[model samples]
Target chain A: MSAAPRSASRADPSPVPVIELRGAAFGYGEHAVVTDVTLPVHRGEIVAVLGPNGSGKSTLMKGILGLNEHLAGTVRLFGEPADELRDRARVGYVPQRHTLSSSIRSTAEEIVATGRLPRLGWLGRPKATDRQVVARALELVGLSDRAATEVATLSGGQQRRVLIARALAGQPDVLVMDEPTAGVDVASQHVLADVLARLVARGVTMLIVTHELGALERLLTRIVVVDGGRVTFDGPPRRFAARRRARDHAHDTHRHDSELAAGDTAAVVPHGPADRSGQAHA
Target chain B: MLEILTTDFMQRALIAALLVGLVAPMVGIFLVQRRLSLIGDGMGHVALAGVAIGLVTGLEPVLTALAGAVLAAVAIELLRARGRTNADVALGVIFYGGIAAGVVIISKAPEGTPANLVSYLFGSILTTRTSDVWVFLVLALVIMGTLWVLWPRLFAVANDEEYARAVGLPVLPLNIVLAVLTATTVVVAMRVVGLLLISALMIVPNAAGQLLARSFTSGLRWAVAIGLVSAVGGVFVSYPLDTPSGGTIVVLAVLIYIVTAVSMAVVGRLRQRRHEVAESHEHEHGPECGHEAIPHGDHVDYLHDGHRHAAHQGHYDEHGADEYGALSRDDGPTGQDEEVST
Candidate 1:
């Protein structure tokens, strides 16, 4: 629904994509997890990567972020080879938030300020501008007041917001989020959705790897589905939903016949209305 | 007591204690943060072998121990950084070998070296030479100067290694630096806090510091304060009580940790009772109240202090955007927050 108006307005957009992957294969060590991926994320586009567990969705994102090794084909960030990208601060990463260590005694502000480390190397300290950026990032995530509070003292959702703020603090051109809404409650998901919506409104580009789509489905411009370690589908969210619905109907008729159906439908499906995922991961 | 504080040896011991107290926790807080709380212990164990090497070869034990610990630290880091199964097993083997080798090697030294080993195992404060104090001072300065340049990066790496690397802050190198710092601290403190018990000085004060401090900045301050008291106080305590300075300092730190823990526990209980009192004070909060009312979920939350409170089943329920209410009362709201959208 949100993609139609944006697509119509993109008649004179940037020529080069923020991230481009061509026939790319990504994995840890010598083993390839995802292969032959052709994807380009442009400015102001929110792309959702969907897949079954261990289906290489994460590996693809990691490959783009230069975490996973690119075994075959090319991966580029901001038109530069992933490995050769000199301006690292151009990309922001929101890793899955772990339980904050209580003993570390880091405040929310301290945690978010670290996002500026790329710009200010180990020896350089955070100046006025850096502090302003950190404060603005905290404000973007609606965590301005929680800045001084110990991260351990924050709620799960608040902790998650702190992580997003940490990413935003970097002032990156593209945000790479790996399951930003995973393991969070509905209300927290909604809050995270609002934060992301605000960010998108500011023209922040995003490439998210998530199984659950309910929280961010409305804002999604396109859906890329990775199955059997390949890009099976790449289209608008509505088309993807429709296609999955038809596939699920065919799958349901044979559900009883196949004893070893790979995915558990309920488990793979996002928890919301029927159209949220329409069916299990394809 | 006053005269003991005046003697050159006593004064030197006190200065050394102060320096040990100051620097041990400075390096220690990061170690504790990395969950490598016992890395200092491992380094300490390894440094003992270096000490034995010095004693047997007739060199300064402190300098030899420093060299030993630094080399072992780098080797352990390189192996651990390689990230394999045997690296872990090798680490354990090395640590075990260090202590056993130290004991075995020290036995081969001159007859009086065995007697001298007592001061190395448990600190003998009066025996802390002038040169040892200068070594401690220089090493302490080096540790502090390094931390000053790398504090934020170190904290970031310690807090989350993957995130730090994602942001491109050289995680492995920082971790290596931390290991080296642990080694340097262990050996520098050996003459005063004994190689055997050096880790206690490194960790216990920081542990105690965390019991009361809620922020990293404050935690560092608290740890240093606790370390100073324990180290300096231990020396003073040993003079009157006739105890080993190392044992006294470790015991003092443990005692401080115990007291802080018990005190915090009691305060938490009191806070629980205080909640009941606040319940009685709770009046109807609506449009008439001056406090700003923010919409929260199914109900309305009144923004007071830093967090929001909503009425739930006739009692005030703490409200959060995610409904995962985290109520820590010490912190206050500093500025305006972006509206949580519906």
Candidate 2:
């Protein structure tokens, strides 16, 4: 039976969150990767989880994917425990670009067909309609022509797009991508941005982990900042920007004070070295 | 060829080869994709021990072998998962233990049963009974049918486990299916190729298949083709040359792999050279000619291109924050916006 429009409305409208994690903590063995984190992801929103390497962004994503053991707190996806949401035909995941080893010689379309695998019968051959869906997914990612191309031959960015196509093939309620634009060229980045923009327009819920602030800044509705395994900030992009500006200004003042304390000798000493190097070069 | 086909044992061996060729390679697709080719070897060794135990105990060898292999496979999985040990390590432990137990069980008897030993270790296709052939055929059919149903799930798991799980595929059951199919293949193969050479049967076909084909499905077809050829071909070779059927089949499979590997290498090189020539021609036309556009289509093109342009490029920038000074930070509005449609 089709879910009623009224039911969708009553469940959670716009600002109402679909995923809520409260004081979440997770770790590998003894070392904690995420701790005391609280964040909410809403439907039809692109929330970028930003942090440095090993800063718990991936850990957070893993928690949402229900891969990691939650040491503390709760993660609810679509108002259900992340693990308990078995009808995750609603969820699409494109893992980190390198998660798949390219030594495997599958075609782009074949890889995309994997997205429909969970929905297939026990002997999971793709039916005629499933093949059509795979084609549609490849076309959506602008990879229709490369459907027969081996994944090992695709450029990094195209592979990323192929991975997205694989996720999109499922026609999920939520799409989670980790660092899609990483190691890709600017043109590929632009193409991927265009694709994400199109998906966003179509109301696909997206959680993208990216470092391309300029590109993601234009796409994301909310910025969830994590530091030391905690949600340091979860708000609008503008608010995040404002907070950073304030923090930077304070940091700049602090640096300036330290520079002033070091006195005028530093600038003169560096200038002499630069002038001598320039003259010697000339 | 007609005379060979006329004999019941030859026909049985040929049919057995066809079935083993199909099932082994089908399952090998997943095993090869997962870089667990040696698991096939480990399971085969375990199967040998099972056959030995069956001979010593006087039980039906095929059934006992299947059960032992399934147990060993599950044991291997459990040990590896629980201990976080490398699969090879777990396999090593089980492989040796299984054989030692089998040897101890076999040595308990004073009078040696060389017929049983020959059948289990080296394989005697001439001794294969019609009843056993029927049993092999049935088991192979059932395993293949089950594998056919679980293809997508198995492929997903082989490609990436967490991604499959995230999309709600029952990864655990699918893993069990893979192990069980492997066990079934070992059992079917035991009647012709014997236990010691079963891994070769599973792996060589796939190795040969991957070299000759492009897609995983194509690889499967090619594996079966090569396997069937080697099986029937090996039987023919053995009959004329007075050699062991199992050894002959394995050798033929290896030879096929070698030839395929050499040919694939040559073709790959030629293709690379052609692409280079094309790339150079495109480059001669200059940047405006869209020489830059082609690199984005290849997987490793970024590593070759990005070093000259972007500093700290493609690294995950957390929360679109302060690390990337060149990019503007713009986190727009918060929460559900009507910008996204249902």
Candidate 3:
């Protein structure tokens, strides 16, 4: 879910690192989901996490939220262990999939206002300011006009945006999204990306778990690659591409040798500088 | 109707109905969201078993039934929390075990105990006691208050538990609280609606509410409204017809649900046809509606990710021509992450 914990480096510093994962290892019973990984996200950074299906990317995301008690390692938010991190008020999350109650019958604005729960204190109602924030979130997600629309009648994309708006209503310091672009269309993807980019520009630290990195690369500050529950690469987007190339080459060579034994030329290709660097790194 | 409210027993029944109205549907929202509609059935049966046990022991039947219901609720919660299998499957197993256990417990009791058990099963709303009314009020207040405080957290966790936790909401306790509240409501409402009819009170209003309401809160409010109306209205109709109040209430609720369902279906069909007509017109012309149909948001761009590389290289070859990839771009934000056609 996170990268190796780094102490506040003087090279770059903000008020504080919003999230830190140190040697984090997460798993379901008897299955290690994510292992021996650390990730640090500070304000104003857009990080994309990439991994194959079953590669434990979602588990790492969950681990940071303390949803799955990772078997080994620690997760910290705002300098406290995740479990003790009470600044939930500063964290917002949009899920990969949402299973809403069938009985749910709220409007989009009302749904967005719910994001203020953590910030509203016990027994607190939404204040005038809270309503303004909700409106802002709706506007950010381009749902203000549909604020009064029935949530159930919304298209899937609108619902997803509503979820994002709900998260944004929290005015979180860190917005964590699990595959925020999973089931939307290309234009909506741009809208969502632009919105998220704008959020990043506003200094909201974002940790996004997504396989759809082509378009997302334009918005990210860094990229993290995970495979078999471990951090294989954590740096810029190019580093991820380089890592992907290495893994692919190793896999391709295995296929090549098998194909050669069968005298198949179709699988063979000349190596290039990019391939060599990836191979060297591997 | 006004005269009925003047009678002490009638007042008790009204109070009980009002209390059950709020509690049942409030908890029903959670059950419906989880798709465990039969949980009410399972818990209702368990409470009936408790009532049978109480009748044999000559204890206050309602109290004993409540205690049994609370224990059953805890068991259900524990099994569900383990998360090894589907919650519905776990509920089925627990409820069946409960029924069997109740049968054995009831059989061991003295003769004539079955009559008391029958009342628990069928309910005797007209006979609701003053003490029962007070208990129902207290329980309803507690449940409603808990919902008021936990509404947002509950909504968040219900949408996605893992996501809620990541955002730092206490999800586990809230779930347990919901289950406990359901247990209490099951016991409290049993006397007014009976075990057999209690779930009707829960599901009917929610079903109707779901048809017309716009949001979760609106659905709840509508469900509560329907329930109160049916409860009071049932009493009115039952008195003139000389019928059992529980049966009357259940029947009336079903009637209301049917009316709401039919109207919603008609309205929904009309809306869909209109939308399709508008869409076809746009296709023939160009963006006449002016509101461009937004494809689902959150569409992933598959080309840039390693998945595309895998697809091109024949890695995970089985996924080549996989519909998931096609769906991915379809789901991406419009015009952003389209895959280059091979």
Candidate 4:
């Protein structure tokens, strides 16, 4: 409850980045998987963290989300230390959709409703406003009619949207999604990009981790390429295209990259300046 | 029929059974949803060691069991939270270790034979003392009160732990809380359901509930209802049949689970066959029809608009839509529909 009130003057784009990391090193044990990473994600900026199969991109995202141990430097959220920041509601998170176990008995709406838990706290039951927010989230994802449908019965694309709606339901200041377009059909991938475009239009800040950035290429305001452990390139989509071939990002036979390749990587339109550059990563 | 229930021991058994029935499934459903159904079973074994401790020390076995189980639960949960040891490995170590230790510890006690531990192993709810009933009542109140306040949070964690952690719910504490509640439940129901059979009471009724459960909330309610019937009914059944209550209760729950499973499968098949019957109206029997449904049995029936047409054979059979309409309204589409929609 002592969580600092977030900056109300969002119209001016607050000087402090919503999420800031300074020379951070994160890993499970003593060994650092990702090291010496300095990155700042501002409000309303859609930063896509791109990498090859085992480039520690996911590790960096997890470190930002406070899932992994911060072995080295500073990691801050809403301009506060990671451990001291109590208001986790300000950050809506959508993990990899596959992490959700199969055969969940919850409805699409019910799964989304859980996103409201951080706001409601222990004693507060879900009120009408909470229900309305959940409905709005489902509608935003075009699953309003599927509000009562069981999650298990939904298709993979539909389930992914459900996970998106779940993250959106919290009305977080920044949404951190891990591979939002992974493991879905080509049509679904485009639909997800459109959904993301809408979310961006609403000025929602995001930090997405994905191997295939071409699907979300149009909406990406900035690209942060993490090859090996550290940041190799951090610039706009256009700059990333020009600065391509600086390093050999060999994407081995990882499960994620292969799925998108086999499953409609072509249907996702390559951007204006980075068709070949994008295909290199793909 | 009611006179047998009026006896003092019967009243205690019924009351205790009702309480266990009410409480077991509340905790069990989350474990079942998380696929940690066997955690309770492992805790039961740990509680056995606690019971052995109590027997040796001349203290109440239930209290000792509660202490042992809670400590083991917290310890095991801590190990899991550390991200080093998996729950599977912890369960293996503690599950076997607890029982082996109990067997050894009980042998050293003066009044403890392997025979003395029999009641502890299988339960002795009929011979439950008044004080023991009061103790269980208090424990039940504690568990229910905690769950009443935290069931939603507990549910969110069980539904998806990563999401729960992201949402800033104290995932570790809540997990530890669930583990502690599980240990307490092991002690509370152990006298009635027995340590060996108690986890079945926690799981079987919920398994039956999931067959027809519409959602988690509904599933939980169904589980509690099924658990209540199995617990109280098993008590009554055991009285007349001269059988063990714990065994009878677990058996009854398993029977209900089988019945529910068989019925659900039957309903699903009936829905598909009935859908085939419903399809004959718009469906024409030809290669152009492109109708391939349920590659089971000899043929598929197209039941639509009061006529059943045999698929691919250009044969039409008349049927009553009235009789089949009830089947059409069956819960929702079967698993077969998932293929068509996706």
Tell me which of candidates 3 and 4 scores higher on lDDT. Answer: 4
Q: Model 2: what TM-score?
A: 0.81
Model 4 lDDT per residue over B266-299, tens place:
9988865764333433223221123322222443
Candidates arranged by lDDT, highest first: 1, 4, 2, 3
Best by TM-score: 1
Q: In model 4, which regions exceed 4 Å deviation?
A: A1-13, A242-282, B86-90, B108-115, B276-342
lDDT of 2 by residue, B18-81 (tens): 7776677777778888777767767777887776777777777677788899998777766655
Prediction-by-prediction clash tally: 0, 18, 40, 8
Supply the DockQ value of model 4: 0.16
- Candidate 3 residue lDDT tens string, A1-282: 433433322213554567887788987786777888877787667788888888889999877776676788777788787777776767787877655553456677766776877777655777899889898888777666567766766655667778888888888877888887777766556656666766766767788998777456687768888888889877876666787798799889999889787664432332544455445545
Q: Each model's DockQ? A: 0.27, 0.25, 0.25, 0.16
Tens digits of per-residue lDDT for model 1 on A1-282?
A: 011223523322666778888889999889999888888777888889988888889888778777767899987887788888877768898886663455678888999998887888658999999999999999888766457777876656667889888888888998998888888767567777878998988889888898879788988888888888999988888888899789798777787556445455645556556655655443
The A-chain TM-scores of all the candidates are 0.83, 0.81, 0.80, 0.81
Residues B125-210 of candidate 1: C-alpha lDDT, one tens digit per residue: 87888998899899988999999999988888888777776667787888888888889888778877898888999899999999
Q: What is the TM-score of chain B in candidate 1?
A: 0.82
Instruction: Return the lDDT, model 2, position A79.
Output: 77
Query: What lDDT score belongs to each candidate, Candidate 1 first?
Result: 0.81, 0.72, 0.71, 0.78
Better of 1 and 3 by lDDT: 1
CA shift of B132, model 2, Å: 1.5
